[model samples]
Each structure stands twice: as C-alpha cells, then as structure tokens.
Target chain A: MTTTLSLEQEVARLIVEALHLETAPEDIDPEAPLFGDGLGLDSIDALEIALAVSKRYGFQLRSDDERNHRIFASLRALAAHIETHRTA
Target chain B: MPAEPAFPLTARAPGEVLFRRGAEPVTTARFLAEAAGLAARLPAEGPVLNVCADRYLALLGFAAALMRGQVTLLSADRTPQRLAEIAARHGARCALSDTPASLPLPVIAPAAEAGPEAPNPAIPAARIAAIGFTSGSTGEPQPHAKPWGALVAGARAAAARFAVAPGTSIVGTIPAQHMYGFETTLMLPLHGGGAGHAGPVFYPSDIEAALAAVPAPRLLVTTPLQMRALLGTGIALPPLIGVISATAPLDAALAAEAEAAWGAPVREIYGATEAGSIASRHTTREEGWEPYPGVAFTIGEEGASVTVPGLPAPVPLADRLEWCGQGRFRLAGRLTDMVKLAGKRASIAGLTRILTAIEGVEDGVFLAPPDLDRNPRARLAAAVVAPGMDAKAVLAALRERVEPAFLPRPVVMLDALPRDAVGKISRAAIAALAWKR
Candidate 1:
C-alpha cells in the first residue's frame, strides 16, 4: 500500500511538471478524475501527459485504446497502469 | 437562363469509392442515394444547423441541404449557447446530428442505411451552400457565406495544388464542421477525384488507425498540433502520398521532421473562413506561398485582400503579407489579435471581455503565449483582479463561458492591473504577471 501511494505521488509530480499545472502535486486527490470536471484537463493536456508518461515509464499510451477511459480515469488509475507497465 | 453546373464539378464513375466509413468503402452511387434519401426527409423551408460529428453524415447533411436549396450553417463551436444563437440568428428549422445533442432546433440523424441509387441533380451556382461562423472581434459569431460554385472552385484549386489525384485516400484529424476541415476533407474529395475517410480522428492512435483503414495513396489533412502528437507517438503510419496542414501556422522544423519520417512532402495551406483555401506552400522548400489558380492578391497600405474567381467580391485578409510578385506572398504577421490553439481560434480581446464580465472580477486580461503557434503545450493565461475569488472559481466560471480549448490556465490573482498613464494595460504586463505566477 505504501509502494502504491509512492507511485501515485510520483505520478502526481510528473503530471504537475509535464502539464505546468498550478496545483501542487501533494494536493492532487489520487482518486479524483483528471479530466473534465475534476482537474479540468482537456485533450491537449492528455497528449502532454502521454508524452511525459512515455518518456518516464518507457511505454506508449495509444489514444484510441479502449482501455484509455479506465487508465486515465484518475491519478490512482494512471499510477497503477504505470506500475504494471513501467520498464524504466 | 442557362442551367447551373452540377454541384460537384468533377465527376467520377458511379462505382468508384467516395468515402471510407470505418473500414467499409462507400461508393459514389451509395453516397448519392443516402444523400437523396436524407434530403427527402428534411424540412423543405429554412437553413440547417449541421452538428454531425461523423464526417460522412455531415457531408450527407450538407448535400441534402444543397439539394433542397437550404443553406447549411457550419460551426465548430457546438456548445448549446452558440448553437442556439446560430439557430436563432439564421432561423434554422432543424439540426442534423449523428450523435445526441441538446440543440435548440429539431434534431435529425440522417439514416446511414443504404438506399436505392438516385440520379445526381444540378444545384444552382448562386445558391448559398454553407455559412461558416467564426468568432468576431466583438464576441459575436460572424457568418461567411459560401456559394456552391465558389466551394467547388476552391476544392478544385486545392486538389490541383496538392496533386490530390484520382484514387487518393484522404484522412483528416480536424473536425468536419470547421471551414478548413470542410474544404479539405469533405469538399476536396467530392471535387478532387479522391476518396475521403469519415474520421473523428482526435488522438494519435485514431489518426494511425484511420490512415491504415484507408488504402494508400493516402493524404493526411491535419493541423500542426495533431501532427506533433502523431510524430511524438513514434507509431509507424501507412505510406502517405502527401500531407496538407492548415488552421494554424506549421513550424518549418516540424514540417521537415514530418517529411523526413513519412517520406512524403508536407504542404501548408494558407486560408481563412472568409475566403476558404487560397494558397499553398511546400513548407520545407519555400518561404513564400503560391496562390491557387484564379486566386489573385492585392497588397495595399491597409493590408492584403484576395480576389478569387467565384466569390462575388475580394475578401480582405487579416494577415499582413509581403508580396513576392506573380500571385505569391509571404506571411509577414497577423493584423488581428486572434490566437489559434489546437485548431481552435479565439480573439484575445473577446476572451478578456468574458473574463471581466464575471461579477467580482474587477479587471482582467487574457494572455496568449508567445509561442502558441509552434508549441503544442502552450495554453492561454489570465490575470484577474478578483478579490476573495480563487483561481479555481475563476477557471470554473471561464469553463462555462468559453470552449475548453480557449479556457485560460493559471489564472493569476492580482491586487490591481498595471495600467499606464493613459489607463491601458499592455499585453506584456499581463503576460509577465501570468508568467511570474
């Protein structure tokens, strides 16, 4: 559980750094939505995050993949996906 | 009077494929049949607000409206407020949408089921085929009328410029409602003797899938933003004949990289909603734009204005141009304070108006990043003098008023706006404040 929490924190930092979000990484709710109503991020922000994630985790996030809706649902979901798929 | 020329200037054999709907090829015969069927069901009287997310359905709606002598209103801004305003302004009787929408008028989804082939009918050259709306400086959506003949001429010119030959498959990332998308993806194929892919290609994967779905020789109609994301994905794309980019200025470095990766020439189109596509350039090879055939430019003290063959009068351009002689010119700078991001256009002044209109917002200004055109991640920034209001509240308010693409990020709170002796705050001041935050 601690390891998962750290991964989520690392991802939160990455998101803030990549997207230049004004929100602090520690303030981001891990289970809250990252798009639309939650973080107010849009498609452009998604592309930026994907590029950052690819560089950090060494895997591509294809935009049209059906799993994207689940993978990008929240900070926790994205962090979990990275934990399973990260090679770097 | 002499009969008007047919709507599609260039005609292909009935059996030839006109569009690829997903993986299935839709022949010209079938498309005409579906359009005719849709047209038969449309109300016989007023203009139509076409909000179809599917390119093929939008084309069908457009064709049906043209056949019925009803002008089709095209707007990329499909927000309920904007759609309602457009419908009310144009007295639109109905809206044709593929997906469910809470629109003001009656919504009709044109049946995609194939019907019996129908004969092609001639539409009047003078008939207003479409009215494209762009955000005016005053915040109202300005309407630009496009006649069927003009649209046909514009498409033919673009086809010749890009060498979009018969059997070429065109796929686009931009939505079909915008003027550039309509001209390149929809109109170009109808008149260019090429087949189009009915795509809502937003993401990199979608672009790759759509391109792979259609047969080569493929032509990618996209903006610089999508091109950057697609290239970043490092995904192998199908062999493309060529690439055509527009809406925002394409960076020469990015264009060169795209050319190197795809082994295809990257061409940039210079046009506007007011005049459609007027010029093209091989981005890696040329610094100046070559105007399309029958497109003449006049560079005067005021700015540049282009005279196209089919439009009734010369349309003034908002871009300052340096004439290179023989109908060629270089884009010097933009005359208006318009900012384009992710293929969406919004004037800074208009955005500022919305920012200040919020109660408790004493003063504010919206700042477009200096590198917005070249930087894919560049976003609009704002500095608000809203006491007791947080950035989240300001952003939430803005999200309601503007499209997601135009929402200001990092809304900086300021005690007071920095104004000069004349009581005018320069853009540099706001940009600096937002940058500091």
Candidate 2:
C-alpha cells in the first residue's frame, strides 16, 4: 500500500485504539469529523491521541498549532498529519 | 547488598548540616554521628516510632533508622487510630513523636547523643527500614515497605537528577513523615550535600517565611496543588535554586510561571509511595520525562516497567506513558484514570491535569456527571479554586488554549479541591459535589 493509504489505515487504527471506536478501521471515512458528531472525540482523547502520535513520530503535539482542530478533524486529516511527520 | 565492606561509607563530613530550619540547622556529618550515637544506645529489638516534631530531630531519626537497622513508620495524619494501626502492623513497642508523653506506645525524647563521628559502613539493606500507608482510597490501608538499599538508591538518584549545588538547604511545605516528603526533603537533602529545614511549613506564607529561614541555594520541595497556590498568591520568595514538585501533576503553564516567579528551575519529580521518585522534568512543556541517569524504562501495557541500571529485572508502572527514545518518555496520568463515556474512551486524570494548568486556577478537578449518559449535554462539571479569577474567566483561558469540547461546563467554584492523603481527587467525589449544584 502507498504511504498515504498506509497512513490513513494507521490513523484509523489509532482512533480505534485511542477512543475505542466500535467499527472496523476501514469503516472510518478520512473526511468524516473526529471531534464532533462524526467520531465524537473529546479533549482527553485529543491528548491521548496527540501524545501517542508524538511518541510514535518523535515531536511534541503543540496545543498552539493553529490547524489543530482541522488536523484532528478526521481520520484522513490525522493520517495526513502522520504522513508529513512520521519519524518512526 | 549487605555491608560488603568493600564500599564502606566515608567518615562523613562533620557539621555538614543534614537539615536545619528556624534558628538551627543539622550537619550531615553531625546528623550521621548522632544517628550512630542513637544506634549505639537504641534497644537491640522492638520497633520505636519516630515523631520528633523538630524537623531536625525527625531527620536525625530518619538517618538513625537507616543506621540502626530500625524501621521508621510514617503517616502524616498520625492520629491515634492510624498510629495504633501502624504500631500494630510493625509490632512496634515504642513511638517517636513530637510530644513523647501522649503516645500510646512508650516514648523517649531520644536524647542527643554525642560521639566521635564516622561515616557508617554499608549495612545490610532493608531488614525493613521504613513503612508507610497507601493513599487508601481503595480498600483497607495497605502498608508499603522501604528497604535501606532502595531508600539509599532513591535519594542518590534524586540528588543527582536535581544537582543540588553545594550548601543548598532544602525546605518543605509537606510533612516530613509522608513518603514523598521524607524521601525528597529529608533524605535527598542529606545525601546530596545539603540540610533540611527544622520547622514545618504549612501555608504558602509559611513556605515563604521558612524559605527565608534556610540559607541560600535553597530547594523548596512541594506539590502541584501547593505550587498553584503560590502562583495565585504572587508571593516574592528567597533565592530558590530549584523547586521539586511531586505527589500530583504540575501543569506545564503553572510550572513555567512558578519558575518565572521564583527565578529558578522548577523540577517535577515523577514518583509514587510504592516506588520512590525515579524521573525528572525540568520544564512543564518539556516533551520527555528523563529517567535519573541510572534508571531505565521498558514500555508495556501497564505503562513503563522500570529497571534502574543495576536493579534486578524491572518493576511495572501504575500510570500510563508515551514512551519516547533516548532514555526518556512523556508521562500520562494513572491507569485507573482512563474513563469511558457512553462507550467513548477518555481520561479523567488527563482532563484534571489540564484543568489545573489553566492560568489563575489554584486547584482544579474535573468530574464526569454520574448521569453522564442521561445528560448528553451535561459534559463535564468541575470544582475549581481560582481565588482571583471566576469560573468563566478560567473557561475563557482554557478555551484560548484547548479545544471547545473539553471546556468544563458549569464550573463549580470551591475554596479548595478535595484531596485525600496522597492528593488525589476522585471522579466519584467530583460527581457527588456536582450533584449538590
């Protein structure tokens, strides 16, 4: 699989692991919302997700990041985040 | 490691004040000599409770406990019931308290003994050196046993991580009897070439005044809850070499502000009663929690299982972690804190950690409404102590930094956050208070 697709799958797995999504990884749409009604992620989940990504990718997840809400907006956005920054 | 004799301790420096506060301070060499004197005089058998009100004497008892092969039992609220529980658990026949006359067990003033001082040889470790009670928010109080070698190792590790400059006097706001307080304030100061303040520090003003009592290059050891209070009060303190915060999460922003206010590096030590402090973070926003040079980490489900460079195997963690490389990792809160909301996973501990870090907040706690499922919009209710700022103000500050979903709804204003002995606030307690509103 391409890095983009792989990253997308990894994000799905992480969302499932972090928030314990009931659905399969493939069931998650990249463009669907993660924080709002789409996947229902909250702040605590955001921290867990952010820290997990930082540890796996090697850099802090800055709270001041302007595109934070958008980056964490969906599986696809998160996957793209991982794609641009995966040290591991 | 029993007294192997190969690595015998030196004839430690005399008058090297082990701890000093008020008008007097203790020298390590003097303290060690006194402990040796106490060792020479203490009965060969039966446990002696130590409650020397004078921090110096209590510190002497601590060193004496190590040297004499006696077990020191500690509890901050050493009420009659707790004392009785402690004495019975250790089969103690005598108790050392500030007031010797009132103790249930036989008590003695532990007269200051004098002798030509000499550094004690490495004795057989433990044989059970110290005992303390758990936070006990769970079940019947559990006892945590501290071995001598482990105590020595923990003290040395903390000193090395903190790098107390010479002549540094360590002062404390927490009781010296509690494990966290005992290990850092009482023990670390001695081993790392410093002294402990004699008087007890109660309020933030008390801490400020006590800081003045101790000599320069001072280390003020406290908790996140207390640090928040200092930031709120905006007190000008003495020249603090470093600040050691433990027993609770020190929010990054609050920590940074404290560092700014005191003009000293605020070092947060990650530790617990079960395991002594093992790691240090110089900055709140610092990404990695560095293990004391000799401490090691191996990440797993229960968090990071740690093995000090020479420790046998590795011990597991009760908290979560973001295991980074290069002998450092980010620490999340306790595992028990991970919560489930309508089958959605989140961490109440993490939420609370973030809450207290918000500017102007003294102490903050986040609780999931018991009827969370019933009230979808209920979100999370919080009880906060923000003295100068109101709930909306705190919410606005949090909104400026964090996401909208995490904004604490219906923030309950409290004079102070409720915490048990170990300074932990339970979600159940939070919910119970929210119900009142």
Candidate 3:
C-alpha cells in the first residue's frame, strides 16, 4: 500500500490550523476562492498563513512579491508554490 | 507670541536622522531633498491618490503633494471599485503607486534623484494638506480635509502627549493611509520634528526586526488588533520608549499586558477621522482621557463635543462621555448605534440597508454583540428572512458590494424576522434567531 496525499490537502490543513477556520481541511474545495466570498479569509488570515508557512517551511514569504495574488489564488496554487519553495 | 518659523514642517538639523531604510539612516536633509526633487516633477495641480507601499515613499509622495499644492487623497481600501470611486469623486488626476497597474488616472512613481537643491516649500496654514476618507455610519467614504495648520497643531499636541522629542524614531504597524497612522507615523515625524521608519512591518518577526534596526527612544504606533497579533507572537521586543494604540478602544488589560511585556507605558489615543488626535490616556494608569494641550471638551445631553486649537468650530463626537474635571473625560457607550470594526465605522442600520438590498433578500437585520474575548475583530451576526437564500448565498452576494470588514459572519436565514410593533428589530430578537450555517 502506498501513502500518497496531495499537497493541497497538506496546505489546507495548515491554513485551517493557522487561521482556526471552522471548516475542516477535507471540506475546503481546492479551487474555491480563499478570500472574499469563498472561504471568507481576510487580509489578517493571509498574514497569518504567510507567517505559518515561513515558520513551518524554511523560506520567507515576501508580501510585496508581485506573484502573491497568483500564488495565494487557491489552495492548489499555494500548495504548489510551497512544494517548490519549501526548504525544510 | 513670537512669529512662527518659515522652514518646512519637517525641517530638522542637517545631520538628524529622520528615518531608517533597511538599516541605513536617512537624514532630514536627505528626505527634504528627495521630496523637493519629486515635488519639482509632480504636476502643480490636481489631487494625488498615493498608493505607495513603502511608508517612506508614501511620506515623500504626501510631502511632494503638499509642496506642489495638490491635495493628497489617502484611502487604505485599494479595491478597484474604491479607487475608481475616489478618482471620480476627488477628481484624482494621478496616483503615486509602487505597483505597475493601469489605473484610471496615470500612475506616477516617486523616484529618487539628485536634483537642484531648493529650500523646502512653505505651505500656507490655510492650504488643505490631505483628505482622509472614513467609513461613516452611512457606509460611504466621507472626506475629512486637514489643513496644514491643523495638522501641524495636531502633530504638536500629539508630540507633547506622547513625549516624542526631536530625533525620536517611530516604527508603526498601522498603514499610513489611516487617520491615526497619518497623524502619528507621518505627521508627528514631519510636523513635530521626529524620526520615522518607512517600512510597513506587519508580522511579529518583521516588526521586531524593524524595531531592532532602528535607533533608541522608539515609539510603536499600532491598533488593538495589530497589538494583539504582535503580543501573540511572544517574541521578545527591543526596548521601546512608548507604545501608542489608537482606532479601536484599548482595554486596560491589553494595555497592562503590553506595558508589562514591553516595559513601556501604553498610551491610547481617543480620536476620529473628523478630529485627528484629540485626547490620550496612559491606559494602565487610568480610564479617563486627557485632552491634548489646547483641546477642550464640552459635554452635553447629546454627547461630548471637542474644540481643538486652530479649528473654526467644535465637532460633536459620536461617543457618549462625561467630564472628570480638568479637561479629562471617560468614554461611555456610543451615542448612535454604529459599529467600529478595526477602526472603520459602519452603522448597523447601514449594514442592514446593504443586506436587504440584495435582490433575493427580503427582510434582514445586523447586530454587534460586545466581544468580551476580543474575538476576531468585531463579529457581526445577521438574520435574514429571504425564503430561498441560504447563508452562503447571502454572504456571497454581500461580498460583491460590501467591504470585507463590515461583512456579517454567520448570516442566518430564518423563516420570519422578529420585529416589534414599530418595525424595529430588537437585539434580543436577532440573538434568538437560529443559526442556519
């Protein structure tokens, strides 16, 4: 048996834990908008997720990075970025 | 009294440090020279929408606007809709932005240069320096214009209140766009002749690093939400001369916690966008606020009104208060039913208007319960009577028009709304509504 899980699931869990969202990790749609209507995350949530990602992984997430909107577009996008950038 | 000095409000001794840009100390001369260069390049007409992310660039943009006789429009709500609204309403001819977006108005970058040295331009006391928009109870962004004299007076009062002497540097977490941020972080440094850190540091580590990088006698200007977040990080902070909290009310406990942790007295400012910084209190020591020097309060049946120096007339405050003698007063509840979430003001009535305005929504109401635990900002719960609308659908519709700060969480759809004979939805009835989400 192989234990293979998607990075989206891992990032979803991280977001839920970091922001203390009411929804469970599995319930969060990977492609659903995380901010302003879908998951209802605000700017504060974005900062918290950024901090958590930097602490959990070994790379700093710059807020002024132009690709921030694209990177944090969805759980799948954020997870993909984390998979490629995470040093730890 | 002696005549006022003709130098620019931000003028300091040549070598005095006024800001730190990534560990490099930026002197007053440097700031003035760069601002003059930028001002020389800017149009001498039209309002400027400053969208500079770096606090220093924002300051330079603001100074250049003042020098060029342009009214600076400061709004933190940078949504395209909000920016478009500002451009339309304020006749904003250009935006000073760091981003490369194509705005309705041309975007001008505040580029640095070694242009011809010119003495800092003199701003008339009557000249309107900047216009700040506050989300009033109407949920519409209302303009509050600050004259150069009023800002200079307010900055002097604040400097005296916070004990920010010349060469004192402040590193703030609040955005430069907000009223308190405008006064303390920018105005205090410029008008009151103190130093400032230009970075918009938000995270705890970033804040700590910014503080560490700056010199001593530093002031940390922030809001309750940001302060709570900073304390939550539990990181050891550098020595701070004082901590200034404004916008939301700073509770005594949080104030004490900050004082104990940071070893600096927490000074809470009581002000609104209408009147910049009116009064301040050392929250750990007392509950009442001492009006800034030359500021007086007249308590009436309606509420408390303030008369500040250099203002034409007294402005009535929305908060109810009683005098404690010697120009000091304690805050009672709000005179009107308005909710202040993270410094932005929105009336419950105004929120209800947006809620019921939804095409599918029939009857709707919103209520704000006092958050004793300091819950996520201010949690506003709503009850709706739309037959087919679910909580998610209602919220989705609301997200399209409403600012994210005012959007109600846990919007419950009920079969019928509890209304009194006069058609008033009582708080008790709203609380009794069952949660649908």
Instruction: Report every candidate's CA lDDT.
Output: 0.84, 0.65, 0.78
Docking class of 2: incorrect
Q: What would the per-residue lDDT of candidate 3 be over residues B1-437, giving only the tens digit for each residue?
A: 96553336565666788777767877777888888898877876879998777788888899888878899999877667777788789999888987676678888988756566556667777677888887766677888888788888898888877778886779887778888888888888876757878775766666787889887877888877667766665668999999998878877888889899999988989888878889999888887899898888889987778887666679888788988766689887778877776677778888888888989898888877666224445567788889887877788788887777767765767888887889776668677553322
DockQ of every candidate: 0.35, 0.02, 0.30
**B105: Cα error in model 3, Å:** 1.0
Instruction: Put down candidate 1 lDDT per residue, B6-64, tens digits, no spaces.
Output: 56523667898888898899888888889889999999886999988788898899988
**Better by DockQ, candidate 3 or 1:** 1
Q: What are the candidates' C-alpha RMSDs?
A: 2.9, 19.9, 3.3
| TM-score of candidate 1 to 2 decimals | 0.91
Given candidate 1, what's the lDDT at residue A42? 69
Worst 10 residues of 3 chain A by lDDT: A59-68
Off by over 4 Å in 3: A1-7, A10-27, A36-40, A47-62, A65-71, A77-88, B1-7, B372-376, B420-423, B434-437
Order of models, best lDDT first: 1, 3, 2
Report the Cα interface RMSD of each model, rounded to 1 decimal. Answer: 3.2, 16.0, 3.5
